[model samples]
Target: MSQARPDHLTWRHRLVALAMGLSLLVLVVRMVELQVVNHERYIEQAADTRASGAATLTAPRGAILDATGYPLAISIDTWDIYIDRYVWAQDPDAASGAAIALAGMLGLDADQLMASGTSDDRGDILVQRRLPYERGAAIEEADLWGIRSLPSSIRSYPEGDLAGPLIGYVGLDNEGLWGVESDFDHLLRGQPGWVLHERDAVGRPIAFGQHAERAPEPGGEVQLTIDRFIQDIVERHLREALLEYQSSSGSILVMDPYTGAILAMASMPAVDLSAVGTDGAPEGEALAGSVRNRALTDLYEPGSVFKTITTAAALDLGLVNAESGYEDTGVAEVGGYAIRNWDFQAYGWVTVREYLQRSLNTGSVWLSQLIGAENFYDYVERFGFGEPTHIGLSGEAEGMIRTPEDQDWYPVDLATNSYGQGMAATPLQVLTAINSFANGGLLMRPYIVSRVVTNDEVRSYEPVEVRRVVSPATARTMANLMRDVVEGVEWHGARVDGYTVAGKTGTTIVSIPTGYDFDTTIASFAGFLPYERPAVSVLVKIDQPGGDVNLGGQVAAPVFAGVAADIMEYLDIPPSEQLVAGQ
Candidate 1:
């Protein structure tokens, strides 16, 4: 009645009011969905915008030390530099200029770096790895846009290639790839840590951004039994001998017979640790062959070295004495095959002492026949043949020995094997077997790693005695016989001045797929010095020696004398006369 509005205007006002109410209801429902149902999802999306990520912090690898705690291989702190591709892509001109500056400082290609930054699908592009700490710090301080650096490390060999094959090398990712590095990788590569933090637009850590981090734990130190001085001595002599003999390759191993601790093991041709995987490094088959630690990996006929085991078994069983005599017509017919002395000279009758000194193949077969096939093979197994030495190195060969039980076994096989043919053994196996005589007939398990030092504790590896192969009386008698072999002869090549040497020489015709090579031979000597109080047992093997002088006494025994003399002097072990006088 006060203002009787038109009916049309009142209805229009009601519709407008309803539409406003519906719009208000829709706004409330949308707010509830975003704040409640999708709350965590939106938060994560927002985090993505702030460039939040967990950065890996690489832990430093451990050091490999020698017997006297000298570092052979180690890792030093460095830095890995990267460019934020996303940030670089946003500004091409700025990326180019920054790349040029970095390239100038780091000796990199400027154009290539820029191209990689822009075209790489990854958000972070690796510009450089293993930059020296000082250089990396300088780069970081410069704060160049789109560039970042993270702490890293690189494997370093202070002694260079001194023990390269044994110490091994690492890959670009800071992981051990060979030798002790590969064998003890778990202990060498410590646990890595990480940091969760927000980054700025250019992928740099934001000063005030939320952050959390866990410190990295460094790896434990590996202590090897190898003596650096002894290693150097062995390597020096071995190289000289290889060159003199014109040998294709060789191995020299020195061990502590009592403890079976490896003092020095050198195998040529050696791989240079620092130069491995570089521009001029060996590749494919050559690389594979170069990296091998041949002392334990390569197998060959033990030759007359196997005679030592046969004689020991016969003496232990009382089947033969040092004075036991055998008739030698220069050759013995066994199983329709003729076995002859190394010199192929007929000695109508020879004592056991002469058998070893002369290295007569017929004499070895005579002893084997007396010992019987079962007893001979038993001695072989007891001496740790046909098995690996388990010296804690990779690629060790388990040697091959066929017995009467095998289908290929024949009576002739026994005759040949008695003189170290029709069988195979590694240089390590030959040494360890001969080492039994020096250790009073006790077989000891050889080991390379002496100890491991960690932040929490120090673990030392003790000497392990596997078994006794003969009586101490038998061992003494054998030692005496071996001593006679060296000293009994006038001007013996194996004789060391002022030291009583006990040893055996071995020379084998190189076997091929068709048969033995008439032109090549493997010359070797296995021996120990100061026989009454043995300190070191050594094995020297020279493969495929050139020229006509390839006999063990001519080529290998002289090298042994030189090496043993130097080692005795270095260890301050008194001469044989002094030792005997003290006793």
Candidate 2:
């Protein structure tokens, strides 16, 4: 042993030997794992690990624009504020100040800000979400430790509640939640561009800038048929009616009858699109109770506006001539059920045209019986009842009609349906049904968007015709009669000067505690303008207008009138009837 000690190995030599042995052992184990034990698992893990450094692609969501290229909704650069609670805990006093200051800068409630204290379960707490650039900058200047700002985009509506339901807002994840925003999501959500970058073991950006970058793909733009000026006019009149009649809520819409392009769509008590949170309970009295698009989604009895379709159908089937006379006894009995006039006044020996003008229920029941139930049903389906126009918009309802096979088909159903009672349909459906008169008896698909544009190209959509429900002559005759209604009779209040106004009033009985036969009611109006040119159509609906006992003429007709007046003047349409006729 003493002789061997004379030739002892150096520390460097020993270290080399130990390192070689450990390397050999590691190689053997790795070889066994890769070749036999878990080869496939390792391979899959390797494949998945490649995504560790993969970049996230951001697709630019398309904007919604008005006829004048004003943005109803747009994506703007914003930031989200967060904090590492553990890091924040290292300095509690400073950390609490940072959170409070962030809340103040972002206009957050003090209690909500206090909830993100050091003891929060999330190691990292989100201090603020979707902070505007100025607010984010202000927070950054505060120089708070452990706080971070992440880049993002927000959907902003510049005009606030204008066309609120028609042009809906989006969520933080770039998903469309409602209305047009949800309808055209795929079209609005463009292909996302990405960055393929190299990251370290901890998934941090590499210092060498070793990455491949691709520019973001912005979504295509959507241009709607909505006219902002007309929309404003309609909103004003709707509000006026709400005040005068003390209604619960209301909606207004304008469309092109031939093309079926919606020009203006509005609902009262509209929520603020710019607000970060809309789903939660309202904080103030100014908040609107229901801002959903009532025109396209809410279903109700269409009243006399629906009468136009029935009258047209009867005339088209040759069951009744416009000059034909009906004996009106104030009430008509169907299956032993009596249907009376709204005012309980009899229209004795009234002509078909006069019945429509008076919106007499007895006359409509007579027309339905004369046309026959089977034939009347055929006309209703032909008029697009119980079916969505398939305008490619989200949340559109097909409405309700008792089919021949469906249950609850009482004889009274047919009788009451003749005068637009005991059946439900959306406003858009009603408008499209009315358009049968404007499109030469051919129905056009009701749609809101007129065009889609991209940086590379612009695409336009024309009016797509569905089918001919009646003869062109019948449509013309009906249009002429509708013109007479707005330009001459009870609905004369709905007329616009220098334009031929054609429309019908609807005072549907509410379906609440008191139903179709009860005293509670919803007031509404549906019409089309410039009867000759047939460029635009309008519909206005007011829910539960409790005062004045006004039908559609008092509450909704004025809205239709204001919108038509503004649009006709803007288009410079020649007066189809004199200004005196409207008055």
Q: Which of the numbered candidates is closest to the native, going by highest TM-score?
A: 1
Model 1's TM-score against the true structure: 0.87
Estimated TM-score for each candidate: 0.87, 0.78
Q: Candidate 1 residues 300-381, lDDT tens each?
A: 9989988889999999999989999989899899988878787879887999999888889989999999999999999999
lDDT of 1: 0.88
How far off is residue 54 in model 1, in Å? 3.8
Best by lDDT: 1
For residues 1-583, write the lDDT of model 2, one tens digit per residue.
Answer: 3554475789999999999999999999999988899964554444346464443455768889887888888877666677755556667777677767776766776556555656652344666666787877776777776676655566777777787767876766688877788888877877755445455564454688455545667899999888787788777877887787888778887887878887788787676665537567354444434547777788899988888888888889887777898889999888888889988999689987888788888888888888887888999999899998897777778898885566779888888888888888998888888888877898888777888998788989888888889999899889877877777684367877667778889998887645454666788888787776777888888888886576888777876787778778776766765444664
Give the runs in model 2 whose Cα sits over 4 Å from its true position: 1-57, 79-151, 191-214, 276-289, 455-457, 513-517, 577-583
lDDT of 2 at 159: 74
In model 1, state the lDDT of residue 56: 67
Native-to-model Cα distance after best TM-score fit, residue 557 in candidate 2, in Å: 2.4
Candidate 1 Cα deviation (angstroms), residue 101: 5.2
